[model samples]
Target: MAKSILIVDDAAFMRMMIKNIVSKNGYDVVGEAENGQVAVELYKKLKPDLVTMDITMPEMNGIEGVKAIRGFDPNANIIMCSAMGQQAMVMEAIQAGAKDFIVKPFQQDRILQAIGRVLARAEQ
Candidate 1:
């Protein structure tokens, strides 16, 4: 079965771009969220195989979301996203327990590669 992924991005356009990339590569998009809090809620509700999450967002950021989801489920597979100039925050998110991260503006190969690696880890 294709890996089920939950996409979390503040911009609808970004979400759509990622969804298109992920789905086209044979992953199942289980859901999408606009912020960290919602991403956590959706994580519990969906229990997707992996999550692609943006670093900056309202009502909480990806670092906090990573921590929260990790708090709830230490084994959750989360990949953080970030734009340029946010390397510090990206590092923090990774330390907070994200399995990995991808930088935007959405390189198709990197995004798919991150998801593939995360799913492979879950399989092992």
Candidate 2:
């Protein structure tokens, strides 16, 4: 079965871009959330195989979201999405339990590679 993914981003455009890429590449997008708070709630309900989370959002940020989701599911497979100059935040997200990160504007190959690697790792 295709891996299920939850996409969390404040920008509707970003979510659509990611959804298009992953869906075309054989992943199932199970849900979408506009912020960390919503992402956390969806995480529990969806229990997706992976999540692609955006870094700077209202209500809560990616780092906080990572921490919250990890708090609930220690083994949750999450990948952070960051813009340029957010290396510090990206590192923090990784430390908070994100398995990997993708820089925007996202490259199709990179996005696919990141997802493939993270999901593959989770299987082992």
Candidate 3:
């Protein structure tokens, strides 16, 4: 089965861009959220195989969402999405329990690679 993914981003364009890439590459996008708060709620309800989360958002940021989700389920597979220079926040996301991260303006190969690596960890 294809991995089910929750895509969270405040920008509609970003969400669509990611969806197109992952779906074409054989991942199932189970749900989408525009903010971390909604992401957390959807996570509880959907329990997707992986999540691609944006770092900056209203209501709650990705770091806080990562922490909250990890608090609920330690093994949740989360991959943080960051802009060009958010290295500090990306590190924090990892420390908060994100499995990995992908830098945007969405490189197709990198995004898919990150998903593969993060999901593959579950097999071990």
Candidate 4:
């Protein structure tokens, strides 16, 4: 079965870039959100196999969103995606139960590799 993924980012362009990369790699894009609150809601509704979340967003930040999702579903497969210089927030996201973190601007191969690794580990 194709892996389903949900992408969360404040910038529509960033989301598009990610969507282009993931979908082209043969994954199904279940849904997308422009903020953390919406991401959490969509997560509950869609139950996608994986979620790629941005660090900073309106309504709630990525770390907070990660916490909410983790609280709602302990087994959630979330990977944090952030800009060049948010290492501290990245650590928090991981501690909040995110499976991994991918720094932006996302390199296509690196992004796919991170997603593949997370999904593979989750399936095990």
Model 1 TM-score on a 0 to 1 scale: 0.94
Clashes in candidate 3: how many?
Answer: 0
User: What TM-score fits each model?
Assistant: 0.94, 0.97, 0.96, 0.96
Query: Could you tally the backbone clashes for each prediction?
Result: 0, 0, 0, 0
Candidate 3 runs further than 4 Å off: none
Poorest 10 consecutive residues of model 1 by lDDT?
Answer: 84-93
Tens digits of per-residue lDDT, candidate 2, 9-95, equal: 999999999999999999999999999999999999999999999999999998899999999999999999988547687678889
Highest lDDT, which number?
Answer: 2
Q: In order, what is each prediction's RMSD in angstroms?
A: 1.1, 0.9, 0.9, 0.9
Candidate 2 clash pair list: none
Q: Model 1 off-target regions past 4 Å?
A: none
Best by TM-score: 2
Candidate 3, residues 1-124, lDDT tens digits: the string is 8889999999999999999999999999999999999999999999999999998999999999999988888999999998844778767888999988888776899999999998899879
Of 2 and 4, the candidate ahead on lDDT is 2
User: Model 1 has how many clashing residue pairs?
Assistant: 0
Instruction: Give residue 9's error in model 1 in angstroms.
Output: 0.4
Residues 12-92, candidate 4, lDDT per residue (tens digit)? 999999999988989999999999999999999999999999988989989899999999999999999998456787778
